[model samples]
Target: MTELDVKDWLVVESLQSGIPLTDRPYAVLAEGIGMDEGEFIRRTADLEARGIIRRMGLRIRHHQAGVKGNIMVVWRVPEARIEEVGQLLAKQSSISHCYERPMHPELPYNVYSMVHAPDPEAARVEVIRLAELTGIDDYKMLTTVRELKKSTPVYQRPEE
Candidate 1:
């Protein structure tokens, strides 16, 4: 893992939630974090190359964009064909995220997906279509009854 210095952590903390919406957002951010624009850009690029930052992009609020329903679909995919099925599900427009995980003693599901839609029925319809497309019959949808927490994890050095 790439280690972050104090200044790097400060920059990460400043951008943990959001970036300024402006013509020169990075310049504005660097000013806020007490760094010049050129250094800020260079450090960000270095972080990316070192794997300290995997991705930096906008996370659109699905509900704000008129997607009202979101369901967590867990599928019991056979170990033999997990890769093929996961790739197919991940490619779907309706499926925002698809992951393959290990099976447990009690839990039979190994593949999971998040499907968001305009309504419950729409989400269910997408799940059905996704099941057909992935060629996996065993699956279940855990409806998002309550949003307890939603956040992006941020890391910073403890104050000395």
Candidate 2:
């Protein structure tokens, strides 16, 4: 992979959560990094084209935005049908995340998804609908009781 420049990394860090909503956000970002607007926009586009950055956009915490509950849902899907079932679950807007995890030999579920909603009951309804749609008769729903830590920075410096 191509290494990112100091300006590119600075852009990434500055855009972690607060991306300014302006006509020329990159220009604004460039000013912050002591570069001219044109250079900032050009380099940012280059970084995106190289896949150094996935996307630059808003990061919203649904819970803080009045989504008061989140449900961790697990489905006992057959290995052969894991992908199909996961795709089905992922299609639901209510499901923000979905993945297939290794099942505990003693446990009854394997496919997992996280659904965010305004309340626990709303989340339950979504899970039930998903199960019905996927023909998954066996599943478990675990509502989050508390969040220990929610936000973390992605970039880390290499150790000396």
Instruction: Report the Cα lDDT for residue 9, model 1.
Output: 81
Model 1 alpha-carbon drift over 4 Å, by segment: 3-6, 49-51, 158-160
lDDT of 1: 0.85
Candidate 2 lDDT tens digits, 1-160:
5787666777676655465789887677777768888877777788789987778756677767888768898889988999999998888888888988888878778898998777988878877788789999888887677878877568743433
Give the Å shift of residue 144 in candidate 2: 0.4
Candidate 2 achieves a global lDDT of: 0.79
Q: Candidate 1: give the clashing pairs.
A: none
Using Cα atoms with residue i matched to residue i, what is each candidate's TM-score against the true structure? 0.83, 0.79
* Alpha-carbon local distance difference test for all models: 0.85, 0.79
lDDT (10s digit) by residue, model 1, range 64-145? 8888879999999888898889888878888888898878868889998899889989999988988888788898899988
Report the number of the highest-TM-score candidate. Answer: 1
Instruction: Give the TM-score comparing model 1 with the true structure, all chains together.
Output: 0.83
**In the order shown, what is each candidate's alpha-carbon RMSD?**
2.4, 2.8
Best by lDDT: 1
**Cα lDDT for residue 66, model 2?**
85
After TM-score superposition, what is the CA distance of residue 140 in candidate 1 from its true location, in Å?
Answer: 0.6
In candidate 2, what residue range of length 10 has the lowest lDDT sum? 151-160
